[model samples]
Target chain A: MQDPLGRLAAQIGSGMKLAVPVDYGGVPMALTRAIIAAGIDDLHLVCVPTGGMQVDMMIGAGLVKTIETSAVSLGEAGGAPQFNAAVRAGRVAMMDATCPAIHAGLLAAQKGVPFVPIRGLIETDVLANRLDWCVINNPMADDTGDDPIVLIPAIHPDAAIFHAPMADRFGNVWIGRRRELAAMAYSTKTTLVTVERMFDGDLMADEMTAAGTLPALYVTDVAVAARGAWPLGLWGEYDGDVAEQHRYAQAARTPEGFAAYMASDVRAGAA
Target chain B: MSTPTTAHEILIVSIARLLRGTRHVAVGAASPIPAAGAMLARALAETQDEPKLRLSILGSVAHNFFTNGSAELFDCAAQGRIDAFFLGGGQIDGSGNVNLVGVGDYPEGTVRWPGSFGSAFLYFQIPRVILFREEHTPRVMVEKVDFISAPGVSSEGIWRKGGPHALLTGKGLFGFDATRPGFHLQTLHPGHTLEDVTAATGFRFSHAHATPETPPPDAATLALIRGRIRDELHESYPDFAATLRTAPLPSPLKEPSS
Candidate 1:
């Protein structure tokens, strides 16, 4: 059989806009590595709200051209060096956003709407930078007063990519409570997933799993890449390798250090 | 006699004091101090039989109750379900304006901090937004922020349910008044003088005739902090929790000199 993971990575060509989830949500680190190895470039990366090591590694590898997200940090591991360095060097374009604004934009796309009205960001510099976002008086307000709110336009990415705990042979991925992944898949043109393992039975057949399952209808492809979210934990499956994360953070501080670290046991062993 | 307190313990106690009467308090990522404070507040409430405090520490499996991912947090804030939250910034001014983005020009700033996460929306929706930053330096507590990730006060007629409630730093605490749109120095932490705060702060703030020292946590509170709170905090913040466990016990109490 053809390597579906490699095939899935091939579908994501250079310059495509890709949407990904936050660190706590399932991050497809293995797929990210595959994309990096494939030498994908000029990718417009949209973090669902925020990102962590997955984003840092991509940025360090010089894969991202434009990044749209609220924040990017390694949490306890401290700042994301490559992201900070790239931003400082003006190597990548940044669309600084707030968490809800990103979600609101995705929600608008999911709903197939032009824009969605959201509270806050009326007078913030975050609003000022994004000329795409607009503010208007609440049309629903009657006679009482003029209430103003921000409106975020829909964010339709070329593809959505993430890892999950399980995906059945039918391509139904069980995202459990991480509904933001569903929103991303719904809003994007294509949805590609990597999972730790494949569920034997049909995910939709069971009531408990069905509610949490993203039906094969929305998912375009599924690739079984066991421990796909390695170094970044899945909710119930495993804990993140904090020591490795810290090692990466320290090594990635310098370009040479990053290269050496990537070539060392960590990246090579993962491959 | 009052027990001696560490700087972190003092900040935690201060945060818990501000969290009083709040039903639900949410601590965002990278906020070990605030999370510890919330846990302490919950413990206090349970012991006192006050209304049950709903604490949500983001990134904690055992603590967080949000099932719908990051969106639900904002949605809950929009509906006014979250009562209190903690927001720290790269720069904060007297008017409560917070700048999480870097200094200098937009897009290509000289320095780049992490982008504003949920501050833009949560600052407006959550009722009690505590501005907590450990470093109380002049650069961080600026006269005016280069960029306002979230404004302290919105324009007239704009719908805003929340704004800055208090500003806590390593040195002291400042209470924010939305009406006056300014900050007032509340109390200085132990070992920190008003002069020390004035020297470190860039923004001007008003203060009463005699500023009192922030009260040290009692023996019971200290025990709870070292024991139960540290263990609870370990789930998400292992490094911080470990430090709390190994932290040397404070020296015996000393008389306060006027």
Candidate 2:
């Protein structure tokens, strides 16, 4: 159950229900396909605000449920600049998810530290809703005495699925970059990893990727899914398919719209 | 007729070097230059000629990589890490404020279009944000944008994700000053001057007195770029290839190819 990828596939209770980022390649792609194969509705997808691993084929598989993203992306493909009329017509369900990964908000929750100092939460209900937010006494002991700090409870996903460059057969994973990935890695209760190629020893032998393996140990299952990060983009070396993206955008703007689009494909149409 | 050199190819090469051999670099929607460059870099690196640089890519299905057609590197996308990226701005104010989304009222615009699609987060969290443009105009570079698409100096309470590093254009290059958070002119390009630059911008600038000019793309590099666009890229995308209706006569490229 702790194997991130495996648990992720199982968490949504099969029957086609899933939510994941909208990315170009890598982990996001793995999540989409795995979700579909696991029997989650492909239409229930969460779109990452930034560039990340995402798959449109899942929608064609009737595996997506809803898109939780920014209000800006709602019409990204349908309007001018570059228009995909079919997507605008509502083939998939799009939701103004309001960027689930608000760095400050999410970071606050992940640390379990009360009142994690964060900006941009001023004067809004968003800051008020978190009952756990508590303030810290300042050194000055000023009468403005309401504390300044806040508490961010850890946000462990039902599971975290990822595609890594390398992983040991035992399921020890290796991620090349450790930006905010640690936040997502530790925050999740379960993790699934797919490596580019299998290896026997610990990926930690290399100094750079050594620390990368620690988080993998926190994961549940490690699988060898070569080139698992498809559709979503990789940063330095590879590029993605532009035409397929257009086709996806044309298909994934609404529920009914995407359903018809899914019907067009055989394998993708039936989950 | 014959094919001449192209700025697009030159721009793509410049970007590949910036990536420093990373397998994937993040890109946003509607940015054709970086998208194309990112794809081309992966293609060249994967080929036997540059086997040392083993790389490929997978763009988003929602049209992130504006390549001419389907991409060959679909497998790499499963890894999903777009830490660095490039963005565009229709209005970049002196304060380094960007506005690409839309302007004016809700829905119906009294003024500009939706300011930025993703510049806000891209500028802060992506680690590397290389803002680029070809047409340097006052409209593009303003004193202050009507809207601040992304916050350069995010409030201390908030951990500002990504911020831009460089501003590239045909006229010159600008890098961000961590202290100032705005642009410090780095280098001017060939056949350009302060007058030409200032004339194009709509904002106030602190120009450097000794700004140097960027050297033009060299002959050898140009030839290599030409070959890729004409022969390699053309073969990949016949439609794009057709755009190159003719070629210019050859000159001193690669010292006559030995």
Candidate 3:
């Protein structure tokens, strides 16, 4: 599919759980923009650990109903204005998870396990509040037996979507050292990707890149959206548009400005 | 040795001192000072031939070695590998409870701050979890946090290997006593007195009769911090690094949110 953006948009049914990449780079901004343009609503958006532009913009556009992840901030570029506003306004349901909790949950799903035990969330309100999560005795106990560990339930999203530096026609995408992308792809039912560029030769042909390559077998769809993760970096390929991010941060400060900033997407959807 | 100019530098060096013997020191996102401290510790270790310090600054492509994202950091901590970590909060209580969730109640927050990221997790896993906040007022160091993002101390039954080690702020450095179950004024920072600490701090604590002043960073240490550490911080914290070029302004120490 040469123009797979439309197909990718179609895959995201309303009320479905959609997993995206973490902060800054690796976010599929073009597809995110396309998804926004498509005006899909009631999305259960799962930011990998946290999300910046994509999550904020989506929430601002009233496309998402729930967000499951940790901190949602713009990192150094002023903080997530839109996300903070929505949370304070109680617009979306948020599952405040840590980076590991999200990863461990995804890993458990990938491994087909019911749950995974992690060494955290004992005394915090995060633990107290998460009635769904359980604290169990460490099965493999040392001399100090019955060590309590927090076990997070598996998180299998309906779809995994991200932007990578390169991908081949065969569906293999080179994620470089960002191996978490592989885990995300494996755990989810559908994996949709957009890439900056496509490699002519097979990505798995070389043993060096093979390890980092998420074989197309796992990837359900591919779209060649060059500079797809805009205002966010593509790892080694390109840097984030810092000025644009700063402008976005300023523009997204208020509800009116946020609406104005996202007017183009709304227009695109209507068109 | 020439005395360091700013209180921020003093706090950075003080934090680095706390990380002297640590093998791996990790600083989370939005923490410019702690990031500098970790980098400074690594740089200092290089000069002194100390045990190799693996400094990991979250969100930095150049500084961090994690190919699998911060999950690897958590994995390392779970295995008892990470020696030190830094955490801050919107509200930190007397018992070492940190509240990063928000100001008010849970499930229905009146004032929502950033949701707890890894504070709850790391505070329980990493042995040395230093609570750092530029603001040291009663508003931040509260009588009780509305929401506990990470509890400083847990019940006896819970398998906890880590909790609050110390509380570092703009005004002073307070050491946490698990036995005391509270923070004791260790040393007041330069330009601040015991009265200032007492007036500002919401939590009650004891101090020794002769509590000395917190030492300022010496010229060599300041030079390393300003020169090497400053350069190293650019990749992860460009905004913070840019601020380090000039001597930091003396803090009137405004409340974090207010």
Candidate 4:
């Protein structure tokens, strides 16, 4: 039998646009490592709003071709060294964006709209850099003076990958309050999820879980990968391994240090 | 009282003062001082029997009330529900433009800070935006930001409802004037002089003949910050809260020398 986790990783091929969530939201670190081990390259990574260690690792491994993100940092641990180096070296195509614009783009995709209008980014370099984003007068305005607004083009990624705390046998994943995951899943062609455990009962049947559950219709695949978001944290399950994160931040400063850190006992031990 | 105020405490007090009279204040992730200040303001308001202040600290389960994840924060801001917010940058200029992207050039720069988060939007939506950068230096406060992550002021025809209200740094506080579209030195922090501020700042800003010093937190305010505020902050910022525990207590004033 094929390893389900490997199968899920295989679903994410090279040179595909993949959307991932923020750090506090389930990060799918295990799946990220699996993809790295598979040596996938030229992936266009999209941070729903921002990225963290997961993004840095992928960039350090020379896997990302482009990054569409608001920001990519290790939270309090500090700047994402690998990401910084890559951008500074012009290794990756950086599509700089603000948080709302990214969300607006995703929302447009989710709604199957061509674009979504947002409030800000006018007269700023953030708007200037985004050639695809346009500004137009509000057509709905009642003949009032021009009401300029930003229109963010829809962002429909090839795949959405993330980790979740639980999933039922029916493939319904309980994302709890991390509704951004739902937006990603709704907007992507395929959504691959790695959950900590399987629920015996139908998630949709339970009143409490139903509200938080992402219907299996939107989820393309689900695999049980315990501690899938390890080193990162699952909202209710455990706290992030800050020490390990700090170590990665420190070690990944230099290219050689990053390569060595990737091969060290820490990476192996995470298995 | 002879309790020497730490820089962090001073900043917290200042932030709280800026946040006063606001109905709702939102803070972003990794902001300890701003988060503490919001908490302090909320606590102070409760004590004074004022209208309840709603605080939404992103990334905190206890503090954040949004059920729709990250989008809701922006959504709330767009509707002008968030009254006040805090924004920091790699560089801030005299015109109130902020650069969170990086330095040098566009796309690929010599140095790269994190990309712009929600500042471009939040800075436009929130009525009172307090720019906070703990580092006070010429490099950080530039004459012109290499990139404008979010502009401080927009043109006359631009549809903007909000912009920079004030700028607080480690050295002092600067108030942004929308009409002149410039920052003016408002008050210097304790132990810092005008000459020191001038040397540290890269951008030119106006100041009165003698800029007043930022008032330190009173005994009552310090007690609240060290006590209830610290305890409340622990839920989101554990390490920062721990440091607050060891902060100096107010010592009784000595009798006048005979």
The top-ranked prediction according to TM-score is 4
Model 3 has a clash total of: 0
Taking the tens digit of each residue's C-alpha lDDT, what string does model 2 give over B88-171? 666766666666534443223344232234343345445566778877888788876655556545545444445676777767
Where model 3 places Cα greater than 4 Å from the true spot, the runs are A1-3, A139-146, A265-271, B1-4, B246-258
lDDT of 1 by residue, B69-107 (tens): 779999989989999999999999989999998999887
lDDT of 3 at A246: 87
Cα lDDT, model 1, residue B207: 94
lDDT of 3 by residue, B93-203 (tens): 899998877876565567777678888788888899999998989999898899888888988777788989999999888899997699988988888988888888888
Could you give the fnat of all candidates in order?
A: 0.86, 0.02, 0.74, 0.85
- Candidate 2's DockQ is 0.06
Better of 3 and 4 by TM-score: 4
lDDT of 1 by residue, A100-149 (tens): 99999999998999999999898899999898889998998876788988
**Number of the predicted model whose DockQ against the real structure is largest:** 4
DockQ of each model against the real complex? 0.70, 0.06, 0.53, 0.75
lDDT of candidate 4 over A123-174, digit per residue (tens) = 8999998898999999998777788989999999999999999998888999
lDDT of 2 by residue, A1-271 (tens): 3444444456555332222333432454544455555655534333333222143455345444443333233222333211122124344444321232233333544675423343222222223333444344444545643434333333334554555566776566655432334444455555555666777776666676576464545766666554456443344435445565566566665556565644553233122
Ranking 1 against 2 by TM-score, winner: 1
For every candidate structure, what is the RMSD over all alpha carbons to the true structure, in angstroms? 4.7, 10.6, 5.7, 4.0
lDDT to native, each model: 0.90, 0.48, 0.83, 0.91
